[model samples]
Target: MPNNKPVNGQKTPSFFDLIDQTPPPPVLELDSKPGTRRLAKLRAAWKASWEEGGFLYQRWEEVLQARHGSWHEVATWIKAAALFGGLSLIVMMVDAAGDIASATLKGLSAAPATGAGDGGGLWGTVAHPVQVFLADQAAHLAVAPAALYAFWQLAGLLGLIGGFLGNAGPRITWVLFGIGTLATIWSAAPAGGRAAATGLAALMWALASIFALRGLTLRPIVHNHPPQYQFNAALHLHATIPAPTPASDDFGDETDNIHPLQR
Candidate 1:
């Protein structure tokens, strides 16, 4: 009789087998056969990748942070730029008006002294002198280069500053935005209304730019943890992550592991 009973120290059936047969573990496919040569190549590639990938990831994160920092800093600059632009435009208008008025008064004052000799003489002499003076003055005023120059120069400057400050601060940016919007509208006004409208438009643009600046700083608030994301590493802080689902028996269980995060 062959041995009907099992030999001593023989392995027993697994618990799962007693209930129902379990499937064999699946084999993993690898790029190379198991050996020192394969491990050497893998190790070399991993080392190189770790060095390069870590550097690249860190640089990318740093670049993102720097961009955000620059944007925030720019917000403050916008408000100040808008205010300055508005003031500049106002000054140009006042300067031009004063120049025109002064030129007119000087022309009138140059009327002749002989005009005082007779009731009619005063009027007659003064009229000729005033006319002559005004003709010369008219020649200068005809060009009106100063007004045009000042208006265009200041108007352009304001437009530039307003554009720059458009994303700078909240209140000032709003002000600048208003100024810009109004200025744009005024620019298209009728010819007779153009000068004043143009000035107003410049002023509006500057003011509106301030508000636009503030808008640039606006970011959607995030309130979830890890409130911000860090890349290429595990989060170390106490925070919530999507809970992992229970794996099936067919899927082998793996331990939950934690790793350090580098900021």
Candidate 2:
């Protein structure tokens, strides 16, 4: 009797007593159990939740908003372009003057034995100075004009290539300037004209290059200004919308049946 009967007995072990004897394993340790498989199911559910939320779409919209807002920031492209153009013009003038000085000096001292050689007279004195001045000025004019034309040609050519390539890398302006410099050098190939023209072209190109570098360094200003709301407001104020007056006859009663013109 003593062996068979339980001390302070309940009829059998209750659910609470059994739970107390053998508690559930911890959450972290549940993954190690063959029967549990909690972590695997949680991971699958998490992936499903993320997919339902359209995470990629949300990321793209964020990027779009940033770009759109940035467009509204003050644009300096026009100012930069105008500055570059002005500097280029000034450089062209300077280069022309330098070429003129160099050519005049060379002409005075080193006469190249022209077709007209005289024994001695007023004609030689008068004609020689006049001829030299005219020739040197003409040569100086040649420098700027030729360089202009050559760069223009190169711009057109590279513009085509740039169009095809789509996105040329950063420092695109530098690349174009380099190409222009090469073209200027190539165009001034003939001997005497070459030296003066190349020197002047080099000076002009250097100044332009400096400006172009500044343009490149600055963030590109895009023309993406939103349509002016003031214009729309003005239109709304000025424009009159006709109110529907009471229609005469049976058409008023059949208003629901009547179809307005489909725009």
In order, the Cα lDDT scores of the candidates are: 0.45, 0.47
Instruction: Return the TM-score for each candidate structure.
Output: 0.17, 0.19
The best candidate by TM-score is 2
Off by over 4 Å in 1: 1-74, 113-263
Residue 235 lDDT (model 2): 38
Backbone clashes under 3 angstroms, per model:
31, 0
- For candidate 2, lDDT tens digit of each residue in 12-92? 332233333433435575357655644444444444323422333333444556555554442344346557999999999
On lDDT, the candidate that comes out on top is 2
